[model samples]
Target: MKFTTALITALFSVGALAAPSITKRQDTVTYKIHDFTERKYNGVNISTLFFNIESPPNSGGNIKFECAPFVFPTGKTSSTFEAGHVYFCYKDSPYSFSFVPGDAQKGTWAKLNLWQTDSKTKTYVGDVEFREPPCRAAGPGKDTVCEAQEDYQIHMSVAGSPTEK
Candidate 1:
């Protein structure tokens, strides 16, 4: 009985030591509007938000924020950005963003993956083409309006939790 008990304890100890340790970290990132442009199209407003990653000047770093163009249908005058519509450019790098889903005014949770394909898959294929939309806003809100882009100062926050092993 004593030998059997010792063997079982040793096996359990070895198994515990072989197991990998996992740690989870939650982080929130805030990005500022470095540049932006808005234009009216078919009675609807189209806006493109640009953010420049902070890097040493003259470093030749190619870090950039790549995002799909966001269209604000008629009656969308909140000036707040929609969730799951922005992506960071880095060789199809995978990233996740957590934010308030629907109406920013409503309390809802939404998560977005940069390389999300279909409903439940993310594929990191290759380089992504970067296309910066044109800036043009005829009247009304001037901040997003390219005519007064110098005064633009909007900050957006994205929260994400990643597991580390």
Candidate 2:
């Protein structure tokens, strides 16, 4: 029968070009804490939000998202505050993160890098709209105040595995 219908349409076009369309994207990341040091961090302080994502020939892997929970007041800090919804890649390269009030876990994880709003799309996906470096307290007894929590900014949606390079 025409070689079994052309070998079942060339095996469904090589299984849709070698499969790799796994996806899951959610957004709502906003964490802002500015403690000019009076030394408080006592009333409410819990943190963990690291999200560094790079999508090149690395193609996306099995990743998931959604993490939220924060309330650090008493020392005071807020440029905004929603902080949550960040998933990570499975095999590697996609440090998605989230934390707050977590048992025995208290503040420190402000890594940033997940930017690529639109470079044209080959599809690995990364995007950050938060910029830092206005001269963050560097002198004078410094230690300033921006008490980690992955230092804030993450909300992307990109999947991987289409014969990843």
Top-TM-score structure, candidate number: 1
Query: Compared with the true structure, what per-residue lDDT tens digits does model 1 show for residues 101-159?
Result: 22233543222233222123322221111222334445565533432233222222222
Error of 1 at 134 (Å): 14
**Residue range 1-165, candidate 2, lDDT tens digits:** 999999999999765534333344333222222211211122223222222222222334422222222233423332233344343322222233332212223334323333222224433333333322122343345322333323333444443533222
What C-alpha lDDT do the candidate models reach, one value each?
Answer: 0.32, 0.32
- Residue 149 miss distance in model 2 (angstroms): 13
For residue 157, what is the lDDT in candidate 2? 43
How many clashes does the backbone of model 1 have?
A: 1
Worst 10 residues of 1 by lDDT: 122-131
